[model samples]
Target: MIAWFRQHGRALAAAVAKVRAQPMTSALSALVIGIALALPAGGYALLSNLSGIAQRTSIEPQLSLFMSTEAKAAETEALGKRLRADPRLAAVRFVPRNEALAALRRTGALAEVFAALEHNPLPDAFVLRPRDAAPDALDALAGEYRRLPGIAHAQIDSDWARRLAALIRLARSGIFLLGALLGIGLVAVTFNTIRMQILTQREEIEVAKLLGATDGFIRRPFFYLGVVQGLAGSVVALSIVSLSLAVLDRAVQSLAATYDASFQLSHLAPADAAAVAALAGFLGWLGACLSVSIYLRQIEPS
Candidate 1:
């Protein structure tokens, strides 16, 4: 175990040395990988922020059951109890006609119009939050409630939520497609970088082979090099994302203030950032393994 550790340490040191030897090349390669990764990662961050805003803004699909004006208080209470008992509903809150009317009166714009009315035109209502936010499920629940006794109307103001959900899905698909293409490009970049390194050290590799060095020994440093480059690139990518979010959040904050809303873009969580780094490292390792396997065989000692 000690020997294994020592060998790995030596290989890692050598990889670091090589990268330092060609600072400009390594930095440029890392920059390329960072930019590619940032595109998809930024999109993901944007989607996450939007989803957060939806949740914070209470975009949950809600069904409002307006009771018939003729419905007695007893009947309204019974309907509220029935709705509360339903397992599919997350919550059910009853709003009495009087309370609804008072709320309307409190609103500056509607107070004048409502004050002139002789009788309260507003009906008793139960605001329902369904456990399932799926469009079909919401529609089904709304249809079911509409048929209930004393329910004059079952209105769902979930069209905006549905549209937002659809848009998020489409955006996720686009991000995935973009990430996949960029991932392939990253692999190609590493492959070419490793190929060039192998070509540059052809004579050295042949000498090591003649000295009876095992393939694993010759491959170790290159593998470490690839992993290092990938990790560095991920650092660059995260930095770019952080900086961009900071800039965008300022503008978003100013815009949100106009509407008297509090919102800010969230940074990637620790787990998510770690996953990105792991994925980048794997891509780099894969590219290095492929390049070394193919080119190393061609340079066998004569």
Candidate 2:
């Protein structure tokens, strides 16, 4: 076991030496991979932030149950209790007629219009937040509520939620497609890079083969080199994403301030960042393996 580890350590050392040997080439290759990765990563981060903002800004499907003018207080009270007991509802709040009128008056533009009213024209209502936000679920709940004894009308403003949900779904699909394409590009980049390295060390590999070096021995250093490149690329990608988010957050904060709102772009979570790095490293290793397998066969000592 110790010998295995020692062999790998030596291979890793050689890989590092190769990377350091051509600093400019390594940096440029990393930069290309980083930029490619950042495109999808940035989109994912933006989508996440938008989804959070939607949640914070009341995107959940809501139903308003307005009482009939003739609905007795007792009947209204019973209906409220029933609604509160329903498992489908996340929350239920009863708004009295007078309280609703008072709220209308609180709105600056509507204040004068409401003040001229002889009596409260608004009906007592129950504002409901449904646990399920699916369009069908919302529609079913609205239908059920409208059938209740005291419910004069069941009005739901779930169109926005539906639209937002659809938009998010589409955006997520787009990001997934984009990421897939970029991932293929990333692999190609690594493949070509490893191919070049193999070409550069063709004579060395041939000599190693003639000296009775096993294929595994010949492959180890190149494998490690690919992993190193991938890891470096991931680091560059993370840095690009972080710096971009920082700049975007500054602009977003400024815009939000105009609306008296507070919002900031969030960076990729630690787990997500780690996953990116791992995936990058794996792609690199795969590319190197492919290059070595194909090219090394062609380099047998004559």
The lDDT for every candidate, in the order shown, is 0.88, 0.88
Residue lDDT tens for model 1, 109-162: 668899999999999999999999888899999999999889899988767876
Q: List the residue pairs that clash in candidate 2.
A: none
Q: Give per-residue CA lDDT, model 2, range 34-106, as digits (tens).
A: 8888888888888888888667666667899999988999999999889999999999999999999998888
Give the lowest summed-lDDT range of ten residues in model 1: 51-60
TM-score of every candidate relative to the true structure: 0.77, 0.76
> Which ranges of candidate 1 are over 4 A from the true structure?
56-61, 65-93, 96-154, 300-302
lDDT of 1: 0.88
- Among all windows of 10 consecutive residues in model 2, the one with the lowest summed lDDT is 52-61
